[model samples]
Target chain A: MFEKKRLHPISIISHIAKQLIDTLFPLLVLVVMKARTVSLGWNIAVPTVVLLYTTLIGFFTWLRFTYQLNERELCIEQGVFLRKKRSIPFERIQGISISAGFFQRLVGVVQVRIETAGNELGKAEAILTAVTKKEAEQIARQIRKVKEGVVHDETIELINRSEQPNDIVFSLRFRDVFLLSVTSGGVFGVLAAIAAFISQLDDFISYDALYRKVQALGFVRNTLSGVVAIFVLFVVAYAISVGRHLLRYAFFTVRKQEDMIVISRGLFEKQLLTVSRKRVQGIIIKENVVQRLLGYVSVHIIHAGGSLDGGESGSVVFCPFMKKERAASVIAACLPEYHIHHEFQALPQRARVRYMLRPVYVFAIPIGMVAYVLRPWGMGLLLLLPIVSYLGYKSYQMAGWAISANQLALRSGMFRIQTIYMLKYRIQSVATSATWLQKRKQLSTLAVAVMPKMFSKVTDVDEKEAEAVYTWMQ
Target chain B: MAQLSKRISERAVSVWRIYALIRFTIFLLVYIIVCFLLMKFDGPKWVVFLLAVLFLADLFLFVLLWPRWRWQRWRYDVREQEIEIEHGVWIIKRTLIPMSRVQHVDLKQGPLLKKYKLASITIFTAATVHEIPALDEQEAEKLRHVISAFVKVDDRDV
Candidate 1:
């Protein structure tokens, strides 16, 4: 048992930094508003008052926050003015993720976030923002021992032996990191983020000057220079993606403790991710066209509730990048229960025609309307029909479901192919739908619902096969 | 596999018809007020005529035709392992909820349902919910108890 203790003193600085960031926009707006009307002294006074007030509050917040761990619960007493206290039981703690921002790294401390099952919108049950790395590890070990019902003597011994060797399952190498960025489609994300940033400044900054600069370079008239500019932009985007990946996942390592898997990674901001083996719902093997061509795949674990990515739906990635064979070996080493035989039952040949027709019908209405409106020249747009239909056909080829006794595997998607393996017990419900035309064709769409609203559907399967799967779900 | 496609109570037709009639009346009132405003603003006569025609078509379809179609389409069955529901007129959807996944069962009755001596059963799972509408009150209670029992046993096993 650990006695009540205050957070590391560096937390005061972190707290102040957080407050400054929070008030940055409002302070900027206020300064802009008062610049001409108010005196220079008054302007400076207003900002100083705001900063001093926030700093005082942050100081009190840091002073008040204290935490303790006992046999049953981890109790946190916090809140500056209101004095709120939360007691979270060891059994209720589903996961604990440790993160260290730039300031925390400089100060040699990490932030520990504890999560329970029913937490909504990514809010942790308790967050210890500043704790030493050794203390954080000790707390995690204690929680794990309690969760697994291990005796205190064994746990105390394990904690006492600081040199205990943990089995290292996998480590992301330099080549793996390079392959991840090149194959990840993260360049598009960087481009989109940069575009969004520029768009936000659209009202303040003028793009006409940049456009005129390019125009003055004679690049507009010479098509070769235009192509060169595009190449330059692509290289810039790729470089940004590589830099971002390196910052986030540098020196990534996966280690196996007695009953849990711990992943530690990051360069600028260190992150420690811990997941219990029993809580994983399934594993997903995913690869995009680029990754497939380059012979690489990524692995992610499907766990219910609480997200690691804050806002977006979270998946626990065991390997950010690996060879297809290595991914299978990692899965076998980490989640042996899920590494079962998967016999896939593919979609029927007749269903391929309907899959091909589906997109054609969807595109026909808009394309036909356009062609009808612009009688002669717009007819050229119909050439896109073949391309769309081919994509749909590819989707049909990719979509499949396999059911053995205990496990159900679904393989689907066209552009980014994903093969998900889940135990039958993890499925909440199964549904099949058919339009009147589909009924006549003896085809139906199968939808299987899993926890946290991850619904997998295989379209254009034989109605009888869908029924068989439905019956097997029992 | 046993096929159990049981329809809801026949009185549900009258209940749906009453609901549709109420909706139609409200829509008609709103339509009349809008038409008055349009005429006052010197809107085109043909636009008013088109609106009137569309309102009439809606009235004919929803008030007169849809209740019967809905009653005919809605069917549900409870098996030992799963609950099967077949619904929708145009799309024709079939949903199968595994008994092990059901978290709780709720028996619900509104003023209209009470008036018709009917109730609906709502089954909740982790991901989503399913409902069987317009069952006889006693039947709804029995179904609720049966489902809750299954959910309890499933919870014990887990």
Candidate 2:
């Protein structure tokens, strides 16, 4: 067993900040409402009391919380009054992640999260809110050593482990990072959200006044100039998106050490995740329309236990941007268990009719209503037919499945293409479904349940091929 | 390929019919309340007639026909290596959950199922859950034990 240790004193302030962050928005709204109605003294007094209460609570929380790491398990005892104690065995821990924010880095302490394999979402089994970077590394190394059954000579291994060299399997290049930010769909997503938010403001918030203000600002004069203004808005959104990606993945690097993949990244604040290799369930290679046109793709790993916080959206991004061909090499060098290929078995030609008819049937009623309402202008609805046909064609072209021995790879998408590579062991279930029409055409949809609910589906595949996948999974 | 041999209890049809009837009763209550408000507001009286016709049609289609059709389609085969479940009214779906992937199995009974002396067995994998609904109580218990043995043979978790 080890001595009980408390988090850094800095966590007292951090805990207060974390608590405030949860209510900061509502607290601000309340303060503004009070500021308009109540006296200035009361407004200041209210915030002061809230801060004092939070600080006092943070102090006691930090004081009460203590953790101890032994050779067998990690034990945590924390509570203001209840005095709850929880212990997690080393064998049960799925992985460990370490991250340091701006403030934590300044104070040389990192937040340590011990992840346990379970069905829970956004939860870490044990979180040591604040520990020195050296301590965090020692804990991680000790856990890894114990998990590997190397606790026999802990002191020497602990020292030599710090000297353990990690093979740099992959990293983002300077130019590649710029290219990634440029082609990232995140910018468009932000722009669409901003557009939606602004459009909603017309109902009550008087967007007319805002439009007039923009007119006054001389950004909009005629329709052509309005186009320029919209273009400027897009540029700003792109810059913001790029800045965010740069901050988050500037020094991104993936390294292989023992049975763990260490992914470290960030510019201002560093984050490192040590994922157990066996804990990774699958891999996904993704490409948006823009990235696909440019022949670039990103690789992400589907992991089981890590929290969604501070990590890549429930799955870790192994490669932010790389050529499709280069991604194969990286997977070969780093994770040979999964395989990726651009070529997949094509769907039968008869199935093409089904894909083409889908968009037409789905949009027919809506387009008819629009055409009816618009009358003369409604003739433009015919133009949508070609676009939808192209979509259907793209879906047919992109959706396919290929099995490489023990691994199954599925490429499928509508607008954004995603190719999921899953080992036979990672697939929870295999399904083959066919409607009457598809059955007549000897076509069935093949789908598999994978982690993170990334169910990969190859629609309108040859039924025999679907049966092959089902048998392979069995 | 061959079709799955095992079939669920025929009592499943009656169980499903009762379940559908409960839902239809709730739908009727809501529809009647809506028509009452429409009458108060002097809304189109035709909607009242239209909804009544639709309600009766739904009672015939769902409460009467759907349960029988669904029960007939429900079939499952649990072999030594895997379990194949086939169901779905229009789009026939066949799923294979390998025995090595099964995480656990459970036998459950609600008040209505208990009244009918029926139980359901749910087989859980790491990512998906499959339920064979409305089996005889003893049959469900046996099926659960069988699947539990298979799941226990494989000690790995996803």
lDDT of each: 0.77, 0.80
Q: How high is each candidate's TM-score? A: 0.78, 0.84
lDDT of 2 by residue, A55-82 (tens): 9999999999999989888899999979
TM-scores for chain B, listed for all candidates: 0.91, 0.94
* Candidate 1 off by > 4 Å: A1-9, A12-91, A132-166, A186-195, A198-240, A308-314, A339-343, A353-389, B17-37, B43-46, B152-158
Residue-by-residue lDDT tens digits, candidate 1, A1-474: 578989998888888888898777557756765677688987788889988998898788889999998888898999987999888988877667778888888888888877776677367778888999788887877787787843121222332332334578988888778778766873346566555444544554346865786578754454466457556766766676777787777778787776667776777776766666666777888887778778888888776657653533446777878888777778888887675343568788888888888889999999989877655656878887897899788888878888876888888876677888878887878888888888888888888877666777888788899889877876
Looking at model 2, how many pairs of residues clash? 0
- For each candidate in turn, the interface RMSD (Å) is 2.6, 1.6
Q: Model 2: what TM-score?
A: 0.84
Candidate 2 wrong stretches, greater than 4 Å: A1-6, A12-91, A134-166, A186-191, A196-204, A207-232, A307-314, A357-385, B152-158
Model 2 chain A lowest lDDT segment of ten: A150-159
Clash list (residue pairs), candidate 2: none
Instruction: Predict model 1's lDDT versus the native.
Output: 0.77
- The candidate maximizing lDDT is 2
Clashing pairs in 1: none
